[model samples]
Target chain A: MVFVVVLLTTMLLCICIGSVNIPLKNTLTAMWNTLWGLELPAGVSKNIILNVRLPRVINVALVGAALSLCGAAMQGLLRNPLADGSTLGVSSGASLGAVISLAFGVSIPGLEYAGTMIMAMLFAFLSLLLILSLAYVLDRSMSTNSIILIGVIFSMFTSSAMNLIITFADDHARSIAFWTMGSLSGTNYTQSAILLGTLLICGGIILRYARELNAFAVGEDNARHIGVNVKLVKLVILITVSVMIGVCVSISGTISFVGLVMPHMTRMIVGPNHKRLLASSMFSGAIFLLLADLVARTLLSPIELSIGVVTSLVGAVAFIIIFYRTRKAR
Target chain B: MLKAENVTVRYGDHTIVDHLSFHLQEGQWLMLAGPNGAGKSTLIHAVSQGAPYTGSITLADKDIRRYKPAHLAQKIGVLAQKNNVGYSYTVEEVVGLGRYAHSRGFLAGKDDDGEARVENALALTGLTELRKSNVLTLSGGELQRTFLAQVFAQDPEILILDEPANHLDLVYQKHIFSLIHEWLKIPGRAVLSVVHDLSLAKKYGTHAVLMNNGKCVSQGNINDVLTPQNLQAVYDMDVYSWMREMLGQWE
Candidate 1:
């Protein structure tokens, strides 16, 4: 309840504070008009509200929630504080996938309806598969240190591939270059809905497995001793988390820290139960991202900053605070 | 009965547990007594199927290799000398994992059965009060008890403990043995634990297997196999003198 109230209210404020400066009441009126299929009053700027602000704001919030939730789940699933959407190379994989698609001008015909996000999703999943394979290969010695190493190595590999692709692409492809930095300018209601849909589905899948994840934190042997199929649980979590990160990375580029910080904060508060922690982190991350994105767009007014920059700044500060608090308690 | 016949284990090119054969009747408290490098831990791990080994281990007269992993988990549980929780998991979560070997999939949001088993295990190990505590915050003895709770939750027919008394106070140590003893009394259940403390094995063990240099030097009734002469032969120490010191401390 606290999370819901905070998130809904922050989203309302973020919607009103962006550069075009739509008044809260007028924005609501425009939204209501759009919802009810009613005609806008003559002279009101419907195009600004309809085409630009609403989709962007909603995407920011949804993408933020998705990424943070993925991060929280990854940390718990991998049992490492540093595990996040980007840690697993999902972001770099998505970027490589997108840049390659753009550089080759290779549009999968007809399914163009599915958008570049689909290709990004495929790349992210493939990268996740590689990471999971590394983890499985090291099954007997599934230490947190080993998983962290795998995540870092894979991220580096995918990022180098992404950099290689970027080097060969034309300046026209630079629009996509901002994606590697994580921008939210180009999303429409179509893309936002896809992100929101993926978020809802992945969130449900993760939440459903929350109990298994809780069991997993104890260690693989204990998990299996209790009757959990350790191999199966690890595989499912790896694949599901990959898809979760893929959705976030595809819609918005490599947004960082939300996943790492939000989940850690929630775990610090609620413990590692996964039942409430996943939901709590999702709410906190969404609100956090929406608020950060608002500052990114409106902080300099006419000149926009990357959404990733805002979150990383806030995320870094929050991570230090949480780290200190966790250390003190320990 | 649980039986190990010509069981051999090798790590890399080196043999750790030499061919060993034994049959433990139901409710038998079997103790493996040996020096530190004699592969007592390796033998336990091998019988528990945690390490690859040669020869055959049969439980309830069924070939061990034929059993499914989950089926074997329910039939046999092993407690290592130390357990490390990879994160700040709650005691309940740690204990709850013992149900995984008996459970099918993601626990259905804390089922009544799993919780009941966790509570029962915690209660048995005197850790029911610490269910919500963070495992990392626990003392070494308390952590050992928590892992004991996990093993208890597994409710295996045959239990294996590798230096189970490490870090535990004598009172809790005795309590741990008593809990296992009481559980074994239920019929068809047995325990095989390695012990450096000969007195513990002498007091609680029904059967004893003495090992040296990765081989069993003697095996049989506790009173027979734990004779001071046999212990001296296997451990190459003055067993009578050490036994007297243990008795002195206990008294």
Candidate 2:
């Protein structure tokens, strides 16, 4: 009940508090009219709320929630406090796909637009598969530190590849710039609907494994002994989290720190029960990103600063404060 | 009743624990004592089904291979030697995980007395005070006690502890073994522990299986199997007289 209240209240405030000076009353009526087929107003307010600001805010929340939830589940699976979704090179691989798509007119030969996005997501997903499988074959123990180092190496490789694309490609202008920086400006409602549905379905599948996740917290051997098909559960979570983060990064273009900070915050509050921790992290992450978007729009006025920069700065501060406080308490 | 016939644990080309056999009667506490590299942990891991072994293990006349992991967990509770907390879990939460095999999805409110059992486990292990403490902040002795609390909370028919007393001081060690002794008071319950201390094995265990070179050298009543001769032969140590003195003190 508290979570729902906080979410709705935050959404209302986020919609009302952008640079254009709209009251909460107006924002509510406009949103109700737009959503429930009521009446409307004939100004920039409706379009800003519907087309520009609203989508941007929601996209931030969605990415935040998805990334953080995936991160929490990943940490649980890997049994490491510091693990995150992209530490397995999933984000770098996705970044490479997105960069390549914009730098060159590469669309998997036959696909275009949305198909290209899917192709980028697929590339990122497949790269994670390859790296993890290699790690598996090299050492069945699957050391977390080595896995992270593998991710860093893969990121370095892809980063160099990205620079190579930038240097050699014909379109080195604004399009590549926007693709690299990331924005919610281009996507329509159809894309939003498709993504929202995908998030719900995939997110629900993970939530069902809540108890199994707790079993995993004890240890893999212990979890398996308690009737969880250890390999099967791990494979499901790994593939699902990789695909989800891949899709999100493909669209948003490498949003960082949401996964790391959100889970850590939730851990500080709720301990480490994955069921509660996943839910709480999503709630806190959504609010966090929405607030960041609010500051991005209002503080810089007409020339909007990128949400990523704002999020990284503010989130780093909040995390450092929380970490310091937690350490002091201990 | 539990029986193992021709149990052999091999890792790649190296056979860690050689072909071994033992039959444990109900209410018999079996202590496996050996040197550090004598594959005591390997043998216990194999029995707990935590590793693969080329042998047959039967429990209560049913082939252990036939039982799945969840069923096996209910039948046997294993407290591994290590208290390595991979995540920051509270003591209560850690102990609660032991009852996971007993908890079903959306369980009915029928098990009202269950809370008492879990509480009793905490009190027995002397972790009732640190129920909310983060496991990462706990000392090694406290963490081992927490693990024991979990094993008690699980309430399995057979308890399998692998080097459970290593980090504990003598007081905690005696406390833990006393609880294990008390736990096996029921007619059907038993304990199989991997122990390095011969004095503990003799004082608390009903049977002792002295292992060396990955095989059992002597197996029988604890006092008889833990003799100075067998102790020197297996562990190659001069602790036989020292252990006897410690046993007298414990008595």
Candidate 3:
């Protein structure tokens, strides 16, 4: 109840407190009028709320929820509390794909506007497969350290590849650099819809495996002993999470630490059961990003800091606090 | 009955268990005794169908590999020496995981029968008091007993345990052995255990396999396998003299 209330309130604030500063009553009234299919009043309020702010807020919400849930799943699947969406190089791989499509003007046949999205999703899956196969080849040990190390190496390679693409580009270098910093300014209803649909489908698949994830939290061997198809669970979770992160990054450009921070925060409140943790983190993440985006837009007033900058700043501080608290308590 | 016929297990190019064969009949408790690296745990892994091997393991006339994970888990349960769950769960939640094979949805089956078994296991393991405590806060012995309760709740037809008493106090260790002894008395249940305590093995093990360098040095009744001569041959020590000295010290 608290989470729902806080998330709704944060969404309201995010919609109301942008550069033009629409009143709360007008914001609510405009949303209601839009919902009931009535024509919005012809004013700056309608244009700002409907065209500018609502899509951005919805996009942030969807991306936040997807990333958080993916983080919870990865943590459970890998049996590592520190594992998150970015831990597997999904973000970097997606960024690389996005950079390639942007720099080379690549376009797929039916996905003109979503060419970058398609590429990002493809590369995200490819990176996961690469990590798994690399680990399998290197002594068949999917130990936590090896997975993390492999993910780091993939991130380095992708980032360097992205850099190479940027260097060769004469006209698109600035645009590619800005996109890599992650902003929600370009979102439209179409992009938001894609993110929302992906979150629903992938979230359903992930929730179905909650029990298996709980068993996996004990250890892979324990998960297998308790009748979970460890291999299947691992594959399903990795694919689902990669898809989620890919879609999120494609839409929002690699917003960092919502996955890592939101789940840890929710776990402190809801305990470690994945079922509850998953839901709580979804709500917490949505609220967290909504607030961060609000600050990103209005804190400097028209300068418009990148959403990734704000999230990383907040996420790093939060992670340090959590790490310190846990250490001190222990 | 669970039977392994010429089961050969290998890691890379090195063989761990070489052409080993054993029969574990219902209602029998067999002890696997060996030095630190004698491949006892690897053999357990092979029999539980958790690892790849050359030969066959059969339970109740069905090939072990043919059983799905859930079905196989219902037929056999294993308790390892240590368990590491990345997140902290309540003791009851951890114990209830044993019913994962029988469960259909989240948080185990929660049927009356499953709940009753979990309760019984917790009581037997003396973990009823800690049922609500986070497993992360548990002492080593407490964690060990908690997993024992988990295996008990699994209610498998066969139990395979690797050093189940590793971190227990003397009283709990004796209690755990007695509980295993009692569980083995059931008509269609059996136990395969790896234990380092020779006195306890001699007292409770109905049959035994003595291993050295992955080969069985002796196999048969407990007395024959645990004879001082066989013990010395396998361990390269004066077993009778060491036992006498230890017994004197205990007195």
Candidate 4:
């Protein structure tokens, strides 16, 4: 109940507080009028709320939920508390794809308008496949530790490749840097709808596996002994979370900390039960991102910070505190 | 009955468990005794129907492999030697997971009967007081008993345990063995355990298999197979005096 209230309250506040500080009453009135196709006293207010801020808020919320769900699932599947959506190198691979598209002017045949996003998603899947194949070759089985180690190596490779792209594009360096920093600008209602659709579909499937995930947390052999098909669950979770992370990165350009931070916070609050953790994380994630974006919009007033900057600042502090507590307790 | 014939477990070019055969009747307590690297644990893993192997195992006249994993779980419960959890699940939650095969949904939200089974298992294992405590804080003996409770909650026809008493103190070891013995009073229930203590094995084991270097050194009634000569041959040590000393302690 608290999560819902916080989410709805923050969502409304985000819609009202961008560059122009419209009062909450006017914000809701403008939204209702614009949505219902009724006349409004301030046409500009309607335009700003409907066109400029609504999609951004909705997009950030969707990305936040998707990333957090992905993080929780990844951590459960891998049996690592610190694992997140990027454990498979999705962010670095997507960044490399985005840089390639931006620097080389690459365009897909029918997706020229969405060439960068398409490329990002494509490379994210490709990097995941590479890591799986590498793990198979090295261990003759897809062990979780092997995949994590190979993903780290792939992340390093992609990061260097991104640097190479930046160095070559002297005039486009600033554009590439801004893209890597992450943003929620230029989203439309259609894009937000697509993200929402993905979140509902993927999140529902992940929730259905909550029992198997709980079994896995006890250890894979133990889960299998209790009747879970360990290999199949691992494969399904890996692919589903990778796809969710891929789509989220393509849309939001690597919002760094929502995935890693939200799940941990939700876990601390709800205990380690994945059934409760998955849902609470989604709600908390939406609230976190919406609030982060609101701060990004209002903190400097007209000089908007990247949403990623605000999230990382908060996430880094949380990470340090958690680390200290866990270490000291141990 | 649980039966295995010509079972062989191999890893790469090495044969961990050579062609082995055995049959366990219901209500029997079978003990597996062997020196290190004798493939006792490997044999247990292979017969549980999960590990890769070249073998044929049957439970109640049906091929073990043919049963769906969930259905197989209902018939056979395995208690592994080591239990390592990634998350700090409460003791109750860990024990409750044994009902996964019988559970209708993902969360193992047990019905009344299932909840009763969990409660009974917790009571049997003396873990009711620690039900809410995190498993990570449990002592070694407590953790062992917790896993035992999980296996008990499974309510399988057969229980395969590896080193069931390894971390337990003497009193709890006797307590757990007595519980297993009492559990065997139910019809169509059996236990297969790997034990290291000769005195305990002689007391609780009705049937026994002694192995060395992946080959069965002796197999028959527990008293017959655990003879001093067989123990000496397998362990490469003088066991006649040791056996007498152990038996004297029991007396």
Best by DockQ: 3
lDDT by residue (tens digit), candidate 3, A1-330? 899998888898889888888988889889899889887666537878888999999998888888889888888878887889999887799889888988988887876548888888888878888887887787453555677788889999998998888999969998888788888896899998888889889999998888888898877888777777776677788888888998888878888889988898888899888878888888898888898899999999889998889999999999999999998988
Number of backbone collisions per candidate? 10, 0, 0, 0
Cα lDDT, model 1, residue A123: 91
Candidate 4 lDDT tens digits, B125-163: 999999999999999999999999999998888999999
The weakest ten consecutive residues by lDDT in model 2 chain A span A107-116
Query: Can you list the residue pairs that collide in candidate 3?
Result: none
lDDT for each residue of candidate 2 in B1-251, tens digit (9 for 90 to 100):
78989899988998888988888888899999888888889988888777789988999989887886667878888888886777788898888777766764465234455577689999999999999998889999999998888878877899988988968998998899888888899888988888887667778889988888789899999888888899888767777677667669978
Candidate 4 local lDDT, residue A38: 83
User: How high a TM-score does candidate 4 get?
Assistant: 0.94
Better of 2 and 4 by DockQ: 4
DockQ, 0 to 1 scale, candidate 1 = 0.56
Sorting all predicted structures by TM-score, with the top scorer first, yields 3, 4, 1, 2
Model 2: how far residue A13 lies from native, Å: 3.3
True contacts kept of each: 0.61, 0.54, 0.78, 0.80
* Model 3: DockQ vs. true structure: 0.81
Model 1, backbone clash pairs (residues 3+ apart or across chains), number: 10
Residue B176, candidate 1: alpha-carbon lDDT: 87
lDDT of 4 at A279: 89
- For model 1, the stretches where C-alpha displacement exceeds 4 angstroms are A42-44, A108-118, A134-146, A170-176, B63-71, B97-117, B245-251
lDDT of 1 by residue, A1-330 (tens): 988999878877877777767777887888798799998776567777778877887888888788778887777666677888777666777777877776666576676524567778889888877776787687554554666678788878877877777777766357667766788886788888778788888788888777677766666555555555556666666677778777777778778888888888777777777888888988888888888888888899889888888888988998898788778876
